[model samples]
Target: MSSSAAPAAPSAIPSEVFEPPVLAEVVRSGFVEGHHRGSLVVLAADGSVELALGDPAAPVFPRSANKPMQAAAVLRAGLDLAGERLALAAASHSGEAFHLELVHTMLAEHGLTADDLRTPPDLPLDPAEAEAYLAAGRVRERITMNCSGKHAAMLAACALNGWDRAGYLDPAHPLQQLVHQVVEEAAGETVTAVGTDGCGAPLMAISLVGLARAFRGFVLAEPGTAERRVADAMRAHPAYVAGTRRPDTWLMRELPGTLSKMGAEAVQAVALADGRALAFKVDDGATRALGPVLARTLRLLGIDAPVVDRIGHAPLLGGAGEVGEIRATF
Candidate 1:
């Protein structure tokens, strides 16, 4: 059966709740005007819904949140890396100097070069790193792409599995086939659709519930498998996965068994040890709203602690430095 056709939404958690003004505002106003609608799906490890909001059955592109599943394909195909490296491969990084260096090192290990990467070049996400690169007059290359680690892992899988490296990014390639399978299995449902992502890789469309379930599976993975390895790597080297300043990395590091990934256009996914998976997409793609929503979700999950401390309780600020809190209603 096609993975996309599988039924995966848990029939629990009320669709609507009375929303207070503050919470309602956050959920309604969003980061961009008229595009703030979002869905949150939380699933226990046993596939029970702990909470849900908006259209739980709504189909959305997971974007880079699908990286770990893709990495699972690479691992299942015999690509090997240390836990730290594996975690980095599944990250949507900040393209910092160290992050780029690691990608280069992975390429070298596979006897490849930056020239082999097909991902478009971009300035580092870190302001300091971007300034440094500009000051040094260094031209950004494919190696500096935030998704380079993922691409490098894809190439390594191709090399290890004896698949064609040149077309590894193609959706029909053997590596991508493996990725599709892994995604299907992790999601516990078939992919609804496939589309080209910002980084030029295939993106999977799945329900918010499906995405949350998949992440829950990742966190609860048994030891010695690629899934567990990816999770371990992400927690151990959170800074390298994104940056110390990045919310995704910081949140993951602060929460002992929490695994989180940030995708393009303000998509964030988090999986907790208690078998709960949370996914949220900021409608307008306003990246600023992501942190507060994520923090709010974490709080709802009873994860307050150093995690909150590391994430900090600062209110979201508008462009004028005024407090711009999310007023989620229901």
Candidate 2:
């Protein structure tokens, strides 16, 4: 076939791709209202498949769940980051006062400014924080965006490596290339696709199985390694990775040795100290269903904690009263 040959016709394509199963159901006043379909994979401590629902092998965008891998890539590029700053570098922060302060400090230390960030300006990710920010008459700013820390860290990596800072987010840039390599190495699979993320960074698509495996690798890696450092920092500073009100923060804070991160559009990945890990994406992109699914999955893993109940508390209301809830089905 010639290099510039026409693409295969639609009729030539096979309909063999798997369809995801219903993972959660919405109930209102004892009536099944709707369903959220998705794919999920749980890997046991020994890296074997423990439980799988739907088509976990299909490639999907992992979104901000890929941050830890990207942070490890930045570390490999010789950008020195540790503790909370390292956590922030891998964060989808809530844009609280502390989160904003650290982002400022990181930029200052790197001889960069908020203007260097490529993330589109937006309000805080946390509802309470966003409300307060709006009440203060503040408009959107790049530094206040959830991915600002990651962008600042990217700029720092470029500065340290003498790479072009202006084009840091470009996939062809040295930093993004390194990130792509690291992601593939960690996931043990080639990226199925490349797209621009909400933060304007290059996004890689991989299967749920690969995503779970990558997170497991981070937790199980040796100390002093870039992967382990990113995992440790995120576990140690859960608030920076998410925020006080987030399930990622709550899970990591309440369950020691656990690393958790959630992405936009109802994507989540979590790893335990013992090497058990899981990743999932709700096909409908319904964020409200994530907590219910996660809590159920944790319970299936034999985890019974108060925090699980807290996370699973997704209630439907009827005129200031709880009517029903979103419950996990699988």
Candidate 3:
């Protein structure tokens, strides 16, 4: 995609606007006060700010929001997988049984094993799946970890480049170096800092605007490019992008020509084929807060498709039955 002009600075929010705030129900138990406390930036195809909220210039840790850029580095390094496989590599998945199976398949295809993955082990995100595993007397392995696909991709990159397979996740490793460069280029800014992610890999820090710009570029990327492949894979196989009944999967599957990805905490980013990018962060890092806010943001941007209605307006159930609904007031 062609680069757009730099976005203008965001407007300041008056204190009174936050005082008696217009509380929006972000989740069943949480409400986000009106006026974004972190930052939000919406850019047009030409890179001009169509909408700016909070500190668009503020540097924030995009976390897994940067995964596609990192995957781009793996692609540039000559890793061969594409399509659905590429999408799985960029996902923050729910560790469903099928997701775990694919991770193992990717590892085995490259003659690697779960023992090679450096990410910590965790129980499956689906409660039913976890119970099934326990009932079957299965032990959790790195293959079952949510980040297994990413690690598997790193291993594949190592195999392709003839690099050391062990310690591929090291920040100083060649794979990581390429990842850093790709992220910087995609975001159109240097990473200001680095930190370890919860999944035991390097995390990048870039401004929200930069993050938004990177996603916009991904959607507009040339066909067959790694970036484009990532977008296509995620969109084509939304189930693998997340898991069965996951919001990320539902949103992407429901909306055509839209790409959505979520990061740890409340970081959510979306890019449209029309050259628009939206990025938002909830100040409290409440995971549940993201769905409602994202629905509202898309609505404000005029994306009122049927899928948006289904995913964004999921009913809030009480003890008896349906109580209040999580509504987003534009």
Candidate 4:
């Protein structure tokens, strides 16, 4: 269930090589200007495949979509995180003031500091926040990195276990090893590859279907279980999981009991209260296509709410006026 060899490279085959279907189209002035090719999968409440496109079986890095599972791993490794703390542990936060405040609090509670984080210094993840930061002449700092909260939680877990904090990001570390195990178990599949994530942590590769299954497992796990706790914390504190302007937070806020997470490179995984789940990735990594595609996918499952409209509201512009839009193809 683990590998020591170098992680295999993701399939770099051209989108047309396997005839992967178009998931979305960029329409400008009512003309189809471009297409986004990718893979997607949807699972019914019973966990059976209801829809699939492209090669859903192919392995892909789910990126930060794997945070909830990683947070569960931290809990399993003996971190007593809960509520907003647990939610932030599983967040790709927008680096808003509130998120930074809690991150600082978490580090202080655990006798850690910004220096303990291994995430590279970066500006806030939210555009508005980044703009304000630059306007104020603030330079990038490790604590402002979007992944700092997760790193703080990791350091706390390391402290709890009395493990070497310096090597916490190593793939072979005890905590990450446990994370690998939990990921495999929750996804119900063997991790086919490994790599370094944007946050400089080990990344495990699993199929789109496996990613969907993992999200569903989290929502449906027995109460008080690590998976359930992570799901609950994230759902209850949607803002902590992402931020005020993020779709993950929006979707969870509008739809109770829904679990939602989007990762870098246009990866998204979601599960409903009834256990219906889905995962998708844009082959070209065009995040602009993610919204329309995701909204259409939810429609197939009979989910049509105002939030869907909000999520799918990616309008194209022309000289400060409405032009057209990016929309789902199928």
Candidate 5:
């Protein structure tokens, strides 16, 4: 419980995060070229893995992909947020007007101020918004940070539990302990190692299997339960859950009832209505590979989605128009 608890030993970076035989390739004109290595896991209805690439057992921090479970915990800790509010709590939202306003509203509703947020203030995650802010000479504020919604939820949980709002980001805080409990239960896996997220909250070392399992549980939870509520809310307001142009938002909008969340460092988790799941991490941490990889995995599940074209391929630029593409090699 001490703040001085030794920092976790840095993890050995995996030699390859993706499963065998290169999952994607960069081809220039007529020549075959560079490729990405990563891992993928597809779960059967019975919870057995149907396919695996690379080493799904290797641990990953899962980044924002873990937000739904954290949102579930906040709900468990006492907060009745629903619809867009609930979705935003599990969001890595682009700092759009709706998203920023909602974060402000949540803080105001809980009698907390932006000063109470422990997450560091940063410019908008959306490139356009960031550009606009810079153009207007606007300064960074906690409410406009991508993780503001999640931070607001954390503060609300503190208010509900009568815990110190100022220390809510501490790993040993009652709020975080509740989060750990929810994560373990949802993942059906033991959590050991820890790391700090970009947002400054404690992150757990969990394998792709555990991450997949967590999302599987979320999709299949009892209709009226907190887990199901989070899933439903995210599905209902996919736009708020991510942004106007994000894969999470697109997938949820185009494929209703699918639970989708992406994390930092190329981590992604997607679950079907029946609780089956796929979770993966791109070895090189290439965000470019995520769309193609997830699209391929979904194809294996018998879905022929059109969004694949929108997100899957990474184009190679050349003088004479399009000269190359990043195609899935697997």
Candidate 6:
């Protein structure tokens, strides 16, 4: 169920290739001079698309939004992670202290080290955590990077299966083959392109529709299976999934049974308990556009809570008070 070769060159295909429609507008001081182009898709429980915007079929690397699927792959590969550890496997954490501590525990429990991490050394993605680290006269480490959780789990998977922990990040590794198979099966589509991710793991290119389909597939998975285990762990430990004050964490908290994960390049995917799902990407890669777009899309899908409004849209700052906002054009 796996393909050895990369599908095609997603690197050559610019995100602007098909030129997705403007789904959001940036208004500053009452002027509408900028906008974001991207695609959005919502799939109903029966797998029929309830809504579609822009070129939904074009290839887009889902970034960390694909983590849950990747986690499922590790589950199938025989890692017995659950709760916070399992959630962390699918996390794009904000690099909080607890987050780093958990990462350390996982590696220590498995007899691995931060040296085992393949992701680059970097500062915390969480601003306060980064400032605090520097104030303590500490240097940036790979463990502080947001993707350390995912990397630790990859190492743990290697530890679990007695595979080559050294070359686990390689696309040719047996673990990654299982990852590709799980990703394609979850998306119900063949990956059309492949690229190395920011964290150095293989990233498969799937359409926005395919992305939504995958998230939907995850939450709707049957009880007591590997797929459901990933979702359950994430849902039960939202804090580990993205850390304090993050959208995915807050969304999961406020909505309960609803899963939200945002990726780099302004990609967002949310799935409901009933199996409805939405996936989108902003062509300009403005992460600020993510909140408003997802808020409006969820509202369109019948989630009308005020919390979504508060967290989903980005606010415009002024000297005294808010003056403008980034609003969904559609």
Expressed as tens digits, the lDDT of each residue in 1-330 for candidate 4 is 896999989978776546789999999998998999999999999999999999999999999999998999999998999999999999999999999999999999989999999999999999999999999999999999988889999999999999999999999999999999999999999999999999899999999999999999999999999999999999999999999999999999999999999999999999999999999999999999889999999888899899999899889999999899999999
TM-score of each: 0.85, 0.95, 0.86, 0.95, 0.91, 0.93
Task: Judging by lDDT, tell me the better candidate of 3 and 5.
Answer: 5
Candidate 3 accuracy as lDDT: 0.78
Q: How many backbone overlaps does candidate 4 show?
A: 0
Q: Over 4 Å off in model 3, which ranges?
A: 1-37, 314-318, 325-330
TM-score quality measure for candidate 6 = 0.93
Q: Write the per-residue lDDT of candidate 5 for residues 204-310, one digit (tens) a residue.
A: 78889989998998998889899999999999999899899788998888887899999988899999887679999888888888887888788778878787567
317 Cα displacement, candidate 1 (Å) = 5.6
Better of 2 and 3 by lDDT: 2
Candidate 6 residue-wise lDDT, 1-330, digit = tens: 996996776556555556678999988899986898899998887889989999888889999999999899888988889999999999999889889999999999999999989888888887887888889999878998888998998899899888999899888899998999988998889999889998889999999898898888889889878889998899989999998978889889888898878999999999999899999999988998998999899899889887788876686888978878999988
lDDT of 3 at 282: 68
List ranges where model 1 is wrong by over 4 Å: 1-35, 309-323, 326-330
Clashes of each: 16, 0, 1, 0, 6, 1
After superposition on all C-alphas, the RMSD of every candidate to the true structure, in Å, is 9.6, 5.8, 10.4, 8.0, 8.2, 8.8
Error (Å) of candidate 2 at residue 220 is 0.4
Alpha-carbon lDDT of model 1: 0.77
Per-residue CA lDDT of model 3 for 198-299, tens digit only, reads 778788888888889898988999999878888888888878777886778887887777788888867888998787889877666756557776877788
- Summing lDDT over every window of 10 consecutive residues in candidate 3, give the lowest-scoring window: 18-27
lDDT of 2 at 247: 93
Error of 2 at 193 (Å): 0.4
The digit string of per-residue lDDT tens for model 2 on 275-318 reads: 99999999999999999999999999999999999999999999
